[model samples]
Target chain A: MSNDKEWKRKLLRDMVVIRTFEETADKLTLRGKVAGGMHNSSGQEAVAVGTMSALDPKDVIATTHRSHHHTLAKGMDPKLVMAELFAKATGCSKGRGASMHLADVDNGNFGGNGIVGAGVGIAMGAAMGIKQLGHKKVSVGFVGDGGMNTGRTWEAINMAVVNKLPFICLVDNNQYAVETFIDRVTGGRDIAKRGAGFGLPSFTIDGQDVLKVNRYVKEARDRALAGEGPTLINALTYRYYGHNVGEKGQYRTQEEIADWRDNRDPIDRFSAQLISEGLLSQDEYVALHAEVTAQINAAVEFAEQSPYPDLSTIYEDVDSGLLGAKS
Target chain B: MSTQTETTRNTLPSYSEAFQQGVREEMYRNESIFILGTDLIERGGHFAQVRGIAQEFGLERVKDSPISEAAMVASGIGAGMYGCHPIIDLNFIDFSLGAMDEIINQAAKIRFMFGKPVPLVIRATSGVALGGAHHCNSLEVLFAHTPGLSVAVPSRAYDVKGLIKTALRAPDPVIFLMHKKLSGVRGEVGDENVLIPFGSAHTVQSGKDAAIITYGYTVVTAQKAAAKLAESGVSIEIIDLRTLYPLDEDAINETVKKFGRVVVADEAPLYGSITGDIASTATEENFKYLKGPIVRVGGIRAPISAHPQSAEAAIPTVESMINAVKKVLAY
Candidate 1:
């Protein structure tokens, strides 16, 4: 086991950073800083931080459109991410991929897909590459519960299991697909149970509990690396805001939001754990907030100063002509 | 005694044999290229096209899937997107609607989206010989209209071999459509050396009277119709536009200039047939080459009728095509 003090502080910092950055994005949206629709991962920070902490940085991970947390948790420079949201040339994808499709492939981040359930297949393919090269790395595909029912997801899952692939599907189940509650659309309340029927090894956990989520992620990663095949983990969490910044979701009432925010908020929960364990003082936690705020402000400044991509980017990448030359 | 006696070597198989042979060779050559479809294994494929493929390729690479059209296409896209080069068989073209999203949106867009092209082969066979409405339809025009996909309707075995070989090497996903009626129809094919370029169209027969232009199963029909017209003192040029999507518009234009009259025949509905596109384009741009208006022949825009008399009236036939040629001559 690692030192309780160091691990707890790290998890707390990650949760705060993720929450703060996304909140800043919401503010930017209000201020006309961002042009496109934004999918907020405000209430789902712990899953990203906890799962990423357990995996190796060299290991490849993929996500769907709502992928700010995954990118930030993987140690991307906040300034670059902010610049990307700003659609600046200095952004991570060189201002090409805005929020829904940000990518820093050189850092082992497969870009997020705008299409549902697309990344599940890609993750298996990446794992197959790792197998072909005889490497110890594994792949993690983080998708939402809405993507679980797609035919492509099933295709990838079946192939992953049959090939004995070293892949893990991190089910980021926030209990809503935009506005529809999970129960309204799906049969059962649990997504991990559905995964079990696919012949995948699975587990469900309190996704807001950073420490607990990290423990299971580590176990899954080790099992995958040893060629034990894929594992599906249904992360049980909640979202504080609507699907995007423009949403005013009337689906969930005030009572539910109040309860989840007060009791199960991951950042506050992790901080409490740190303080109770004598790892972080109250003043130290307060100071960490100030530092995170400064970082967000600096990121906003860099984004404001950055340039948009030139129009020629449209024709640059579609064809490399590797298969055969076109006449 | 003649001391200089030379022995000539003969080896290449016909085009269809080469395609059938290539599947076997490539399966043996690479472990990852899998051949999958519905009931293909027990039926030895719908037209015996993949007969003995499983025996030579083994069960792993040659697998039979359920009757789930969307699942098969989605899986093929998934597998191929990662690393596997999958050759998927849609038993009939009409059922392609079920998996259109997977085929059009996901499989075709990935290369352009991620800035890395995915190489996959999609094989389809379609027609109305059978009584099943689900099984009886000609929808090649649907795929030909999709932007990112490349499609081919090989009218002969030589084309089957060359195009399949070429399609296997295409980084962009391709649809290899073979008309069901032309399955066993044979011709001279190569063993392993032919590369049918995607946009190359061939003029099968040359004539000054008119050009009978078409593709897929209609090539043979047009040729038969041309033969009938030839005996009646009509010279008709039969042109086969093998590749559909990256259509050889240039060749079609040059041929139209040489032969001032043409009859565009197809198996799809006449309303939006690829024949309509060609005729409309030629009329708009190559009006100078026209000594007569282009005649269009195809299904009369209705579901294929299983009843023989009604079915005969539904889609275009050899006699109907000949009638169309006469109409073009009058024009």
Candidate 2:
């Protein structure tokens, strides 16, 4: 709330855009336009909008399969990204790359991977590249609590630490992996403490507060750029939707969802603070939501007009022609 | 740097030298190309294939990794997926299980699931040696079982070099099975940047009697049997299945029609082996072309033993290959 006018408005607009973007996608999916499922970051907008607000455009990001939030915040065209979800040719990856693998290399958006813990290695690789090129850019590996158990994640973390590579890993602990609660799945352990196990400094933050997430990420980014090794920011937030849009809510109680929605809502909490601090008007906030809807509508329109990919594209871009094993 | 002496150095080098040259060439060709694996640091590479590389390229380009083989392989896959051309060398075929997840799941499926081709080479040594059971065991069949993977087993120096270069240029994951036995084999390699694409076979010997099919180190064993069979007026055709996954099924059938008898020989166990697959498929598709039932020559189903006698017993010997040819001929 203390920030200057332009940045505050930019953050507010982006937050609204991300929220509206999710709702628009939900509607589109209902309309049969989006063939694949979307990972809704509806209630957790501040973590994405605020954390991404701190990073540089040239810096690379290694995101999970549910990566629309990171990609949108980082600057992929809404139309092309939507076209990708629709499996259309006009998408960034020519429709060959699906929802789980959206990428925009021009914007330093490394492709999202469906395999858990796979992106951690990519982030470490990017960090190594940073060292090789002597560039100031630090690679960010956005992981989830589910990925913490994968051996490859540990490999990436250890290598990054041993080499003192410039990187930041954001452990988005949404407190649940599918139906399993993090406390139960992780055996009552904190993800930040797990980072400390690898000897990397970890920051456990209130991810609901955009300012808190942004401040921590900026500090980590600055430290990495200064040659001070990797940092793991344990982002504590919750998802409004299920693990995916098609998730069956057989695990958690409606009571838990209600309590979180009522008490610690990210967007609602942030909006209240801004309104109370006189930084944003309630009427102006309503207008921002309307503007976000218009932007999303324009993107969907562009995507709908886009053509589908051809059959020839199936054989393209592969390095090897021996499609099957040569055993 | 070698372009000045390129013509002179372009002569047919041994498979080992050719392999070294291929990696050196790729590194020079692309700045993104780097090497990683165990035995790379104080020791050049575990197999001496990457020897003296560290002194030339230093530790960055020629990386030395810890004994954490799985992590090493996954990191290479990650780097390869991250838009870098990386060739990861596994110390031995036996140690490959350490990196199985990355090789099987991540590296292989990345392009298929995500539609981003992982341009990478996993160059490793396999097959029996006087070098004990651990050093032995050609598990190319295991990798060949996986989808979206290309397995290249080069017996000749020309193939060793050309295949490595081809693998580097490929967008899909390539498993280059370097036969430890054929490391010293040399031939007059061509002067051009040769590429022997997949889906073909090398008929080491052309004969009209019985056809014996094999690959990797067993190709030599099959050749030995063919040479002996030729002395008996029984012409034998040796089909070296250089690459295994996208198998040359057409070639196998065509050869079976010509010879009317086929025998599959391999160094690995018979069950679920490439040799078994070939034998079964040949029987089903080319049954009428059969002079006899397809007999397969392979090791017994068990882990390789350390004793030389047991190890020899575990492989498809030249004698066994000859015996297999006779049984097929009798049919």
Candidate 3:
């Protein structure tokens, strides 16, 4: 990684922002401030932050429904994201899409998909376009462990390999696709081993470690740009909350949640590592948390003050204008 | 701005050849345009709709994909969002059922949800021609019901060339359906630069009596029925609605106001068809001008069989349209 102190501090701040932002959104959703269902990615911040830090500004990424972390990590404005959650006119998508469908194409984030494994094919297509345009950019797609079993995902992987496109499939294996455990559907097989069937290099890594995640993704992006084809990385992580905010179920125990939150929290471990390396001090860490929480409060205030889209403009943007205008 | 050869413009081309020429001309004009589907590279397409595209534009533009309909359509949308404009070819319209989620939920709603322009086209051969249930289906109504998609069902060779050109140049997603039965039928075509705008209906035949409004292969059936009615001294007018989504309501209103009697025909099943929309438009907009009930002629609500006679009976026949016009006229 980089020896620059600012870069290290920025990484820590980024993860903290994602964590605070999601927790705030969850609280707002429960109080009926937000519009739609919010998928929390609080404990899985390292996977999004670390992997995204390795990408170039020109490189693109397609994400799944639980995407607040990825959207922010790709450099989207937090104010616009929070405004979208509130269904304001100034949202990233002009309030047309809420949390589950955030997108900023100019920022190289292709938006999140509600359907399982749908974003994978879309990312592969972007990779194909990049290859056809002769650009040195790699396309990354994030999927859950359950998304690996989808027929569409397999087809995308196979087609990407056949075309030799620059692509990366990042699996945030959180061990659960909703209430169903990954082992029940995957038959206890390693998600990384499944990549061998497609004839590409794959690896299983500790996603809790931000430095390792960053290094692995950087190598994959390098291979893709060198025309060496695609790579699949299974980043093992966990979610602190339920599948969705305020979900009512007994599938996971309180002890299990405590285990991940207290023992394997990505932000806590990374901060500890930073302190050990003398890159940060306990006093600085506390101050950083306060700064990020304040930033998130400002974003929420911006979303609250923003206005909803006018009813008269409902018919706008239905199409991109008619064809054969002059003829 | 066109690379069309003189030979292609002078002669009357078949529907398939006209479609191929339209794609070729568009690719020559737009470098970002590419065609992807099964059997497109060496085998040219299932119906030869893009025969020489691979040889002309090379492998990068003319891609032959595996039998993955969902991936093909999803990737096309992605490519369209990026820099490339893609034409995803589903060999048969019936095969589009496999990728309904990608087409309906993703491609059709991407622009509305994400506020990004998806400049893409999905070309598929529709209508029944004795093919099995897996091959023959008139599912244009399914796409017509969608909000962010434009559905184009062109009938003759002239329309095949003109409508495809319009679809290629369209800034939004378009579902361009070419009838399977009209692939080999030859007709007069305009110059290579001709483009027919969507929501514009072509008045095929004019008369003072009842009118028959339809599109796609059914337009040919309506013409035959009108010709037969002409011999019997019943002059039935015909209006061909080339595009379904951006419907030509003005033409339908004019036809309703002038004739005061109408018959709407479609190849899709009777319930929840395009005919319902046309009939509703006539009653809602021009109800007072109606001299009689607006009859709707459509196919049977069942799967088209492989048997030639059974398949023929499943769709709207010339006799069915003739009876529909007579019923409206006799009122």
Please give, for residues B251-273, the per-residue lDDT of candidate 1 as tens digits.
88887787778888888878888
* DockQ, candidate no. 3: 0.68
Tell me the deviation in Å of residue B231 in model 3. Answer: 1.2
lDDT of 3 at A71: 94
- State the lDDT of candidate 1 residue by residue for A40-138, as single tens digits: 899899999998999898887778888888889988888988888877788877766678777665566776777777767667656755654467988
Q: Which digits, one per residue and each the tens of the lDDT, describe model 2 over residues B35-128?
A: 8777776777755677777787787788767566566666566566666777878877678887787788667766754556677788888888
Cα RMSD for predicted model 3: 3.2
Worst 10 residues of 2 chain A by lDDT: A318-327
TM-score of model 3 relative to the true fold?
Answer: 0.97
Rank by TM-score (best first): 3, 1, 2
Error of 3 at A151 (Å): 1.3
Off by over 4 Å in 2: A1-4, A27-36, A88-97, A133-136, A246-250, A273-279, A299-327, B1-15, B112-116, B128-137, B145-147, B182-200, B245-254, B276-295, B299-301, B306-308
Q: With candidate 2 superimposed using the best TM-score fit, by how many Å does residue A173's alpha carbon deviate from the native?
A: 0.9
lDDT of 3 by residue, B181-263 (tens): 99888778767789988888889889878899999899899999989999989998899998897888889999999988999
Docking level of model 3: medium
Q: What DockQ class does candidate 2 belong to?
A: incorrect
lDDT of 2 by residue, A152-187 (tens): 777788888877888888877677777788777785
Q: In model 2, how large is the Cα lDDT of residue B150?
A: 83
